[model samples]
Target: MATAGNISFIPLTFILSGIPELGNNQNWFAFPLGALYVIALVGNVTILFLINREDSLHQPMYFLLSMLAFTDIGVSLTTLPTMLSIFWFNYTQIYLQSCLTQMYFLHTFAAMESGVLVAMAVDRLIAICDPLRYAAILTNSVIAKMGLLILLRGLCVVFPVPFLTRRFPFCKTHMLVHSYCLHQDVIRLACADTTVNSIYGLVAVLLTKGIDSLFIIISYGMIFRAVLRIKANEARLKAFSTCISHICAVLVFYVPLIGLSVVHRFGKHASALLPVFMADIYLLVPPVINPVIYSIKTKQIRAKVIKLFRRREIGARDNVIATI
Candidate 1:
């Protein structure tokens, strides 16, 4: 069986665009993969631009959403272009070192995303459970600190993968079977003992994604308890409405990701397309639908977006009148 994956040909070129080249030897996939990456890039950048520009979007929730969007940009930039080249062009040459580095960042961002979801859940729990202290608790400085903490923690978790794998000598058959830079896929290509590396990667999954997921569940469970206890009918309705968007985002992210990981690990014989499709959904769906979810559920954001669009329309009308 031939590996459909492409290895990075120009190892250092990844530094230029933050997109590691899958097969420097194969530029044939530059079009399709480049196009999808360009879409992901534009979409995520637009999200960041909106969050930064809108003063109303400077809340804890939107701040975290912006971070998620920023991470999406990072993940997409780090991988899809390379993966696309491999999938489309059948480029299968990657240096041992570059492959390990790609695996590190890929997992790093995945862990950070898990932690960010936890942070967002905590933010929601606070806002819902305690209204008066929300301002003092989740300030801008605090939010920044939380973001930094998540980044640092996730890096600590994922950094060990590459360091451990790179220590091993890779087997001559360096081809990877999957579409992307996966830790297991890369390390399995090593000729040296990989038991320790595989164990370490498993520990990473349990600690970072597993533990963080538990915390998020606990936070939301508490939130559910609080929501149920509220006495005012209209207030309760409003609270549930605010949570609807977050609930949707949480399901969108956790479901596809957990499914992909579960199927990839357990059903190794399953078609690679299952995990690949799940990853695509996990990475792409949240950013595209997140803003839509929030806009529909959050009154203030909906109003602000409407106001911005109306202003653009009025400006265009004025320009047309002037031309006439």
Candidate 2:
């Protein structure tokens, strides 16, 4: 325990509550969570490998996709160990440093994901509206730089969060509402004035998620305008069709995030499990579903995936026949 400015901080640890309202039934909750973790891990890894192997996927679009996949994996892996421990082994306690570290990675990757989505939108806008300059605009060097910039931007903006929280004395109960640590859920435990923390959080969310969404929407708006100028309906449809997967990705990523934010801010009177459920979906759904959506929507990726699976199946069959 430490004292600062007449405020006392005690028990510098947090107890993570994994669907505590569910009580003893929290064990049952582990099944779905484990499934999500597996799916997210497998799905994002497959996307990365597929993009790396397939020559056809060497374009700027797929490059941005690989970045997204990496960030998705980061988001899931950040919380998986602690979350599983809490759900299955009843290990709810997490040290202050561990909790802050988890929060940093989770939020950083989330911001990076948002940035990648914006990059993808811009890629589509250029491909659709200015096809001639697409290659020149988003060359390999530019793509690499963009990826680095996105990562650095996330790091710079999120780096101060843990430090800011560390300044205040956490005299209040340190029981987090969800399986994972979040800025909002963790900051309230502080005994000091959290106005700075709250204001910074709001600013960070607006700058990353809010601004990225606005740009994405505007990019699509420009894309639609460009598509409308095409005389041939088929060409317009083809151009618009390329954006479906991105649109789905954006929806899956933003809808839940926004919904969860809204619920947190206004739905305080709602069921305890409701916010936790939304948080789970917000964190878990994008990584697991993004790859599935892309694989299904993009014909090239789907064919490659099917071909890869068939090859494995054939190899197994050949081994059986050899044994016979």
Candidate 3:
């Protein structure tokens, strides 16, 4: 059986300085990574709150957007500090329990993100293809039910990662290739036997995340087909513009995602750097761009954003005058 070897790396200074005593013994990536992840958490939490409170965002699409934001927050929480810990302190010795816990949350959040995207695709299909029933069919209660289904489905799909990974024996080479304890990579460290875990991992991925992406592709394909049938260029243009932001979001999420799992399964250090950069881009780009994307693409949302900003500016001016 193979488990990760204890690897060492360049420790981050700020993290080392934070807890001076453990700086020598413990991994020193806590401070900067903690800052970055906290920022990400705050931004995503803001988006979730805005999407929840704004009346304009009452639609099914925005509901799913909030869910996506929640998933991103979970993902960043699960991966960021661990990754920085691995990179800054080269501490790859995850205990049996901690490794499995990371695998579970990592997979759970991954599934949740995919599940929300699939729901968004389905919502788009209804809105575009059949507008009349959109409101009645996607009512608040119905949306809640869909959310429940998404969570249930994600839970069912990812339940195996931890169980399967835990059963394996680790003789040597437990050093995870990627920064975090990805499902496949953690399983690879099992020493005793892992053929079953490998098979199940593939199944879980295919059934959940892969299937969701496949259906999203199908949804877009149908949208493109419908676009072709529309005789009015202006109508087609509006429909195309609406979907563009979602397409861009999906691309940013899915492209480099498979790399982490793929590289860790068969080899080591093969795509470590690629996955590291991609991991940062995957989590960072979406939250950074989501607000801007909606503000630019949707007229009503843009108005709300502008109104909020104008209110803030007026308040600031009033405060300055009051002080004078």
Candidate 4:
């Protein structure tokens, strides 16, 4: 704790404000939030299982997708404990060290997700623009290296945040805006100068998400140019169709992300619930939606999922007959 003109501040624990509008009725949100968590967990796990079980999916594209599934799971798991505690149990107090740990994983997973998306964009660019070299360029070894680089980049970039956040003395008002700890939200509670933390946070976001988005856009531009060059309309349409799932994934991840950032940075006068809602959407929607989009848009995944269920049905019927 620290002193500011006879006032004691900087409590060891922070209180989470879970949907201030709901107040005592916050428990009502537990059902929907729990449902979303279940969907995200089941969906991403199913994608990973399908990708792993199918030998035909042992390709660079599917490999990147598996990485995305892992990242989504990380995102979902990072916030689940705190969100559940706040909504279900009304347990909102979080220790300083614990908050920092949550902030680290949350930001790290987010950065890693952005990195995976950029890698996916590059994968698509090579596949569409230079089909002959796609196999040569994105070998298993190369993909493995890319995955390592993404992990390392996330680790290095987010490693400083906890330390930076720990240096500040927080104000007496220990209430946080959301159920889970966030760098931006935590920094705002500091009574001391937070310029360094703020600038570093912005830099981290720019270096990761901003650069990743730019690269994705450029890759898509190249893909479009290559697709347009195909003389046959059918071939052009086929090439374009392959990107639909990825496009949807990108939009799902980035749109809510951008909205949340905008609300945090510029929407000072906006409803308190708006930022909270945006944050929830940003974190929850992608995990629940990405696997669904891929399953629906990618024929191979859809077919495999259908085949898996059919086999399960057959096995159940066989067991029933044997028992009878």
| Model 2 CA deviation exceeding 4 Å by range | 2-10
Worst 10 residues of 3 by lDDT: 8-17
Residue-level lDDT of model 4, residues 169-201, one tens digit each, is 776688899889999999888878999998999
Off by over 4 Å in 4: 1-10
Model 3: per-residue Cα lDDT over 66-185, one tens digit each? 888888888887776566665466554555566667768877887888888788888887887777999988998988998999899888888866776655555434455455666655
TM-scores, all candidates, are 0.81, 0.96, 0.81, 0.96
* Candidates' C-alpha lDDT: 0.72, 0.90, 0.69, 0.93
Clashes of each: 4, 0, 13, 0
Pick by lDDT: 3 or 4, better one: 4
lDDT of 1 at 316: 100
**Candidate 3 global CA lDDT score:** 0.69
Sort by lDDT, best first: 4, 2, 1, 3
Q: In terms of lDDT, which candidate is strongest? A: 4
- Show model 1 residue runs off by greater than 4 Å: 1-39, 87-92, 309-324
Q: List the residue pairs that clash in candidate 1.
A: 6-91, 7-22, 7-93, 9-24
Candidate 2: residue 11 Cα off by (Å): 3.0
